[model samples]
Target: MAAANYFESKCFLFFLLASLVVDGIVAAAAVPKQQRLDRISSLPGQPPVAFSQFSGYVTVDETHGRALFYWLIEATSVAEKKPLVLWLNGGPGCSSVAYGASEEIGPFRINKTGSSLYLNKYSWNTEANILFLESPSGVGFSYTNTSSDLKDSGDNRTAQDALIFLIRWMSRFPAYKHREFYIAGESYAGHYVPQLAKKIHYYNKAHSNPIINLRGFMVGNAVTDNYYDSIGTVTYWWSHSMISDKTYKSIMKDCNFTEEKSSARCDDAVSYAINHEFGDIDQYSIYTPSCLALTNGSRQHMRVKNALLHRRVSGYDPCTENYAERYYNRPDVQKAMHANTTGIPYKWTACSDVLIKNWKDSENSMLPIYKELIAAGQRIWVFSGDTDSVVPVTATRFSLGHLNLHIKTPWYPWYSGNQVGGWTEVYEGLTFATVRGAGHEVPLYQPRRAFIIFRSFLKGEKLPKSKRISLQLSFN
Candidate 1:
């Protein structure tokens, strides 16, 4: 009887091992790698391209039915060997696809007529596999079945959702699972990128094998702190002759620039400075020509007029946003990308007013988070477009000063080819650069120089110093 019991136990152990192995196989098979690919045979009115493109929704929350939209563009050359970059755009609620992909760093730019696309000669995808995400639900094509999810969205929730999205995204595209990864974005992404990086860093420490091979992150014309951003913007306007000495003095006297929520007097003063003092010019890029020609004849026409005025100034396309809007709303375009599968209620927009208005949480400062990430030995780069008055280089400089990091390398002029690209300074664990002639959207204004800086950041190298120009041009 004892011998019979021992044989039965052995048989039970064998069957249990077999069951475990089969369960593993089923789990792995559940995520079919090739099936999730977007397989863009052709984009409407697009010029033929060799590289592949994919766009779809990745459901991050099953219970809440929350899904985020993404566009993945493979590298122009040697895609398999290239690193992966996840790009986000700020507004707390902006569409990375419309702004980051279409207007900024992605491979294609929407034409003025909103009927076709054009190649961005300096597309970031040429250097790495670019993935643009519309995150936190209710932004761009990303949405939630539970309406409350939109209202409840905040900084913490956004970070958590993004972390989950990255994990599941790797499952779908297993080729990039162990690939070197980087996160990048501009404006409010200063908050999103670092917060998400911190979460991933914590997860990596807790797990035996890290899922994301995260290397570092980069932000441009970013909002590091409300205090410094506000002060820096006001300072830039005054210094650049955008605001009157009287208005600047009033702002300096009445406004408490150090607080997240300013007083009523401060609000009134700022409102006066922007609406009355600054007039109709774009506050984002002070030197850029405002889009005075948009007569959309809609209720939000004025708002659109103001927003569109903020486009990159160097080769400003007044109708690009409108073009992107029209293209994204098309039935054919949606079908081709396998998007809007559930028939979302609202029309696609570059920036979601709903999400921006309903944003529940924002940090007063990202400086502390920057310190933490730097201490963790992650690569951190902050770039600013010199022409952006909204989050001016002055503000970034002020914020970095608060960190008081030891200077690893003094300020110097970084070069792109023979010409001076911008100014760069290296700190103990951070690097800062200013893109000359670039606005809030650096790539939109100076694509060649932006590409140079991006490539340098990715390769973990310093921005090339100009051989002819003296280092005296560097800012203190």
Candidate 2:
């Protein structure tokens, strides 16, 4: 969770997964590469399950005096030859292992009581090697002694450092040089994923290294444009009947977006939405059902009557909560031992300002990177969960509109059952998907759907078509 920029009314805006964790200082005068190896070696292994693990530190930005701590889990089935997926969680200062691993798609799931790790039936590790990184220097267990190094945490530097880390990481594990690499993340990663991809693309071109084979990228409920994200939220609120039509119109007139202004308009609009109860606004309640419930045009699913009662007798569905305690907040883990103990920082809170500073000044954008990838014959995907008012699907759609890619496969329903929960669109070499009943954390909320989407991404396959469907322009 990136910091809450209450000034912009930007609540817990995360760039997904990138931050430097400050853990005071380690006792070792010099970072012991061997000790680093031993610490990581202590991780439990499932070799019979075909998983190989690798860990090491990489200096991502020498000028800024920054480095990264990361771990790689190789899928046993295709250890020698498989694509690599880099997963990041958006906290600005949150640990990728904490969210991406424990909460989302790593091999293990966290126990909800925040106590232990459990085997995950839907782990993404089943598909390919997954790399989880703790970036910058002050997030999670990653540490730094130089307080000066903590200053000026910006996006460009983060991207540069991430690129540096990847190059160095790949060198350590040489076999992955020729492998296909794709970046995926959610929330604030709206900035991290694209910006990092842009830098990687630039370096790949400058160095002419075929070894740095860049595939495409993925983002969930990402924040691309501040204006649309905020405005779209108001629109979401009004459409969901959360706000009055009069207030929605007033908000539209009051909120003004300008390139000259940083993100003040977005803040103002959000305040307006909250103050007015979303009157005619497009924003959805962070705690309520999504606009999908209100706008599926009678095609939506009605909950089964007495399903809850039947669940008591039949053991319906399983919902486990604390899969993260295994890696984060662990008493024995070195990272946990060095964790920040100043305040009661949630290992999994929705927001944090300490992390937000890492990217408040980032000027990097992914559209140019997207353009280059497209021209280079690489496939790309940009998706979001429709119900996330934070980084709603509307903003993502508007951002993609800038690409001007003619919708070759237009919007259509991609279903798991009789349900039409989400939508998809396929353009030349690009596939966009929206998971139904999903929130900012798409994979966690809609695991089965997320698996299908990612599986298709790994194969470079397009989503199957549905009957003629058009993108909905408005809610009502």
Q: Tens digits of per-residue lDDT for model 1 on 385-415?
A: 9988777899899888889999999998887
Tell me the spans in candidate 1 whose CA falls farther than 4 Å from its real position: 1-37, 295-315, 467-476
Candidate 2, residue 178: Cα displacement in angstroms equals: 1.6
Q: For candidate 1, which ten residues in a row score worst on lDDT?
A: 299-308
**Best-performing candidate as measured by lDDT:** 1
TM-score of 1: 0.87
lDDT of each: 0.82, 0.59
> 225-335 in candidate 2: lDDT tens per residue?
655555565666677666677767866775564343435554455455555563332222144333322232311110110010000000001222223433355545433
TM-score of each: 0.87, 0.74
- Model 2 TM-score relative to the real fold: 0.74
